[model samples]
Target chain A: MTAALEFREIDVSFGGTFALHKVSVGVHEGGWLGVVGPNGAGKSTLLRTVAGAVRYGGSVLVDGEAIDGRSQRERARLVSYVPQRPVYPQGMAVFDYVLLGRTPYLGTLASESHEDIEDVWEALEALRLTDFAGRDVATLSGGETQRVSLARVLAQRAPIVVLDEATASLDVAAQHSVLELIDRLRAERGMTVISAIHDLTAAAQFCERIALIDDGRVVAEGTPGEVLTESLLGEVFEPSIRVIDVDGSTVIVSLRVEEDPS
Target chain B: MNAGRPSSTRLRWWWVGGAALVLAGSLVAGVMVGPIRIPPIEILGTLINKAPFVTIDTAISDRTEAILWEIRMPRVVLAVLVGSMLSAAGAGYQGVFRNPLADPYLLGAGAGAGLGATIAIAYGPATSGWFIDPLPLAAFVGAIGGVALAYLLGYTVRSGRTAVTLILAGVAVAAFLTAIQTFLQQRQSETLREVYGWILGSLNTAGWEEVELVAPYVLVCLFAIFIGRRLLDVLAVGDTEAGTLGVRPGRIRLVIVVFATLGTAAVVSVSGLIGFVGIIVPHTVRLLTSSSYRVVVPLSILLGGAFLVLADIVARVAMTPAEIPIGVVTAMIGAPFFAVILRTSKAVVS
Candidate 1:
């Protein structure tokens, strides 16, 4: 079977500085791939390039089709990305903001129809945000806002979902809820999930396969146990850590601490 | 969510319908009293008589007939056209820029129009002592040219033009043009009075020709913006998000700018640069409705027409025989009202 998303030799540079250096990876259909990397490892750039937000060299394929060649609208229909810091305009109602996810399906000259509203309502319901439908996003709590962001991507109904550190600022409870929701969606809907996660423990628990990136290159790519080894993480992150199995899933727990001298 | 009265589609229609009713009232009032106080009944009769196949017995005298049909009606129509055009463009600009303070003329239209009118006053047939003012024609061209220059400068920065860069480019262009205009005004001291009068803005010379000149452009541009108001809502989130959602922000913004500029230039050419109606009317609409452009655009048109019609009435009657410049009247009214809005609402950023 064709992989759901494939980045073959993806290279991105900014004014002679490389962001992603001939990086390549692929995920099978419906697989959840978590990207773990140190700062400046080009994890965010990889997702952004695949989302076609930035100019990139080499080929990115979504379900065996080149992503760069597709029109923006066509790509949006195939893939939806939730950015780390999405700007939500003040005074926008939750329902209205989520309805924007239906834009790819909408004509340029047309507004949201009843069917589009129905999809928005369903997405909100999935995220347990039905009660806050008419609330302005400005007044929302952090957890609610994160859930609302997820609800927007859920409303898009794209086959492949990419979360680029979208839950980094989220609290553990909110992060759990978001990851569990994505897990449920992948299981029930058979959709692909690719994420750039800072939480090694969360990535170990949630992701079936993990890709370790260091200095704009993928150092390892395999199942959580295969790739998220103590030596590999120690070498890449410079943190002494231990990987433990909590039931069937791997969990990364810090074994040592480097305290600030000050 | 302040839960400000359930901002659904039904409530939005109510706002539109309410504004339309107020606009009708203002239109009638605009026609009835202007230098000559024609009675309400006579005004109503004259309006009905002019309708197809319906000629009522002449309750209004012939002078009243000429005043109502030829003078006040055209002026009132132009007022509506200009008011609605500027306000819609203003609201559209605010949406594009994602800033409340963004006005219709923020993209060099006002300065360009003034420069154009000044050039005509200083260099055109005014030296021949002809009453045929070439200011309007020149103003229109200069307004479009100013915006074209801004667009070119903004476009060179990127294909997906960001609002901030475009706004900066516009301000730079407007400042340059204004400097030139001032120099021209100083050189032609004899024509300075008329140039100053034009800069202060007025609706004194409004007529059928002016109305005809502005109607098509304003109507077409307004229709396009109304159809694309949803994109404006998406745009408020920012361009990259808008693009990721599959709505090309640059393309939509360009379409809006083209039509809005055309309509605005037409009105500015006919009526000079009446201030505040564009900024005030749209900001008022946003306050009443949510910040959704879908609701703001149409309401801006309706309320803007009403606001300017009322402002023009004040311009004519405030001093009672000595008319003030309509722009002066708007600035006086709008400045205070804007301050009040700022004090009351937390939405105003600057």
Candidate 2:
């Protein structure tokens, strides 16, 4: 079967600066790909480009169909996106906010049906947020809000999901929970995930394949072991790091340098 | 089925009841305490007896009937309609921008209307029969023109068309128009006081004719906004997200802006720029209810109507023989409440 999403020679520019240049990537059905890069490395821009949020040169295909001419709603129905930080309007109940994912299903003047309500409940339950259904979204913690954002995409029921630094604001436990939730969704629903993650270890732990990006180009793409080498980390991340093999698995650790006062 | 959880239906009904009570109270209070001081019982009697033009054996004079039906009733109705339009427009603006601080006048509509009215008055009331009509046709035309200009600027110069940029452009446009209006008012001293008083807003001279003039536009705009309320909710989730849901945010925003500006211009021309009902009423409704435009839009209509009626009552009875401007009453009530809401709630503006 063809990959769920394919980006071929995509180039994206913002004002005078090129954010992404001639980047080619593919995500297979039920695959989990992790993108890791430093700040201003065009990580978010790449994902946004694939999602058709920004105007870009070149082509993106979902299920072997070109998506360049597709409307936002049509693209949305194919691929759901969970932004880095979700901002909720005040006094918006968590349930109502999540139910907004059903916008594509609603008629112009009509309200949500009972099925929509059930879907909202199921989404909240999947995220273990049933207790927060009536609570205001503004009262949620960073982790809870992140999970809620995920729930919104889950309710969209799209086959592909793009998570843009989705767990960056969460605590370690919450981050693990969020990743596990994504894994569960992928396994149960046969969905594909493309997460732009910052934590290299987390990326290695969760992603089936790792794509290392630098200055808008993909430097390496392979299994975590093949791509996350000591030299590669040093070159791409500009950090002193050691790669060790522990129990048939490679682990990367950064070494902090001591400051010299001369 | 969660225990003690209020179903959306029940909560909506509760809001409906609360809105109905407020409307009834405001209407009774509106007809009772004008300069004529008709008792609540007498007003009710007049309303019921006027079905087939019943001749009441009470001491209610012809001036009293004229005041109640011809003057106060239409004024109150106009206030309700204008209030509803402003609040609905404010809610629409807030939804479109995804910002709590957005008001109906964010598109330079008020200033443009003001400039239009100023220019018309400067040219003198005897300029044309169209000008002599109490509707402020020039102001309405200017408001629509201002929005059209803003849209043109947004389309031509801006690349991505951010909501923040639109709001900034609107503010700049308002300031520019207001400056021109002020200069023109300065040149024409005879109409300056009338123009100034109108800008501050009043409901003193409203009658059935003014109500008839503004009602159709308000109804049409309200219908359009109501139909598009769900679309507005989609918009609140950011433009890209809205697009993913198959909505063209740019096109939807244009439609909303045009319809909302029409409603706002129609009302503002008649009411002379009554403030805060647009900004405060919808916001207060949102605070009590949820941010879903489904609930906010309709509730805004009802609460907005009641709010203005109550404010008009206060404007009329506060000083009795000498009436304060309706805008003054709204500002006095709205500004302090707005401060309180901002201080107490964690609602982010953008």
Candidate 3:
């Protein structure tokens, strides 16, 4: 089967420094692919390239079609991205913010239709954010805000959802809940999910496959059991890393490298 | 499930209707409540008679009629036009900048116009028979030029960092232009009163000619902004998010800034640097109603019209005959009101 989303030799550079250098990756339909990387490892840049938020060389294809020449509105219909730090304007209502997801579908001169409003309501309901609809977005808690961001992307109704460390700001419990919600939604909708998650354990648990990137290159790409090993993570992370299977659950921890007795 | 959230369509009508009613009331009051007291009923009748295919005969002297038609009506209409124009532009600036305090004048338009008016007053022909006066023409060119210069400077610095660079460039440009204006004013001491008068702003000279000059630009800009309001809402989320949502923030902002600057320059050319209407009106609308550009943009147009008309009424009446410049009235009112908004509404200021 053809991959739902594919990035081919994507190269993104900012101010003479390569953020992503000739990175190629793909995720099949209904598959959750987690991208794990060290700091400044080009994960966000790769995701941003797919979201068309960054200028890059090489092609990003959706279902066997190159999207470079497609209009932004057309691309938006295929992929919805939730950035690492979502901007929820202080005065905007949660409903209005989510309703913005329908922008690609609406004409410049047209107002939101009944169906658009219904879709927003559906997304809100699915996220259990119906109660927060009228509240100012600034007033939402971090987890709630993350959920609201997800709700906005969900309302976009794109076939592929790309999240760049969406749970980075959330607490541990909230992170799992948010990922679980996304997993359940992806399963129900059969959507392709590509998320750059910082926590390896959570990524292993939620994502079907994992891509470990270091220094603008994917060093390993396989199922959690294959890609995440003690030796590989230790090499990439610099700190002494340990991966242990606790009752069939992958738990990754980084131990402080003891001062080498020089 | 959505009860707390007011139905947008129904609430929109109420907001629009209420604002429109206030604007109508303010316009009528503006025409009627002048130094020459004409009965409100008679003024209404005279207004009705002016409408196409309508006639309402009331005992009214030729002097009152002249005052109503030539003097008060034109001024009132110009106030509405300038008020609405400034508010629309202000809201657009605030949206694009994502700064609540951003106004139409934030981009050096006011300072450029001030310099232009100063140059015209200091050196240009004092009187002319030309269809369009040289002062407004010069000011229009200067305002657009100032914004263009700022944008170019911003682009040159870093094309990607426009929002911050543009604002900084605008400040630099405005300060430079203002310095030139001050030096020119000091050199031409005779034109000091005239230049200051223009800078302080007024609608006292507003006639049918001035009204005709600015209406089309105002209408065009308002129409463009009306269509782009939703995109403006998307822009409030910042560039990356807006781009991800398929709206090109740079393009949309450029379009909005162009139209807004055009409208603002047109009005400022005629009315001078009317302070605070741009800041006060849209902020007021956002406070009382919703912050959604869909609501803020249109309601700002109406409420701004009403706000300025009311302020112009105070400008005309408070000192009586001496005629305080409309800008003074707006500042006197706007400063306190804006402070109150900042203090009271954390959502807006934030």
On DockQ, the candidate that comes out on top is 3
TM-score of chain B of each: 0.92, 0.91, 0.94
CA lDDT, candidate 2, residue A37: 81
> Candidate 2 DockQ score?
0.44
Cα displacement (angstroms), candidate 2, residue B93, comes to 1.5
Docking class of 1: medium
Residue B260 lDDT in candidate 2: 94
Candidate 3 wrongly placed segments (more than 4 Å):
A257-262, B1-11, B129-131, B159-161, B341-347
In order, the Cα lDDT scores of the candidates are: 0.85, 0.82, 0.88
lDDT of 3 by residue, B1-350 (tens): 55455443224677888998999999888988887788888787778888999987789888888899999999999999999999999999999988887888888898899999999889998566665579999899989988998888877895465688889999999999999989999999998999999988899899999999999999999999988888888898998998889887878888999999999999999999998898888887777777888888999999889999999999999987788988999999888987887678645543
* Superior by TM-score: candidate 2 or candidate 3: 3
Residue A38 local lDDT, model 1: 92
lDDT of 1 by residue, B245-334 (tens): 887788888888888888889889988888888788887766656677887888988888888888899999999888799999988988
lDDT of 1 by residue, A72-181 (tens): 89889988888878887787788888888998999888767767877888888788888888778777877788788888888898999888987888889988987898
Least well predicted 10-residue stretch by lDDT in candidate 2 chain B: B2-11
**Residue B316, model 1, lDDT:** 91
- Residue A153, candidate 2: Cα error in Å is 1.4
lDDT digits (tens) for residues A1-262 of candidate 3: 7988888988888898888878888889899989998999999989998888888999998898999887788888888999989888877899898998998898867888888988999999999988788889988899999999989988899999999998998889998899999999999999999999899999878999888999998898889999888888878985478898899999999887678799
Best by TM-score: 3
- What is residue A193's positional error in candidate 3, in angstroms? 0.8
Collision pairs in model 1: none
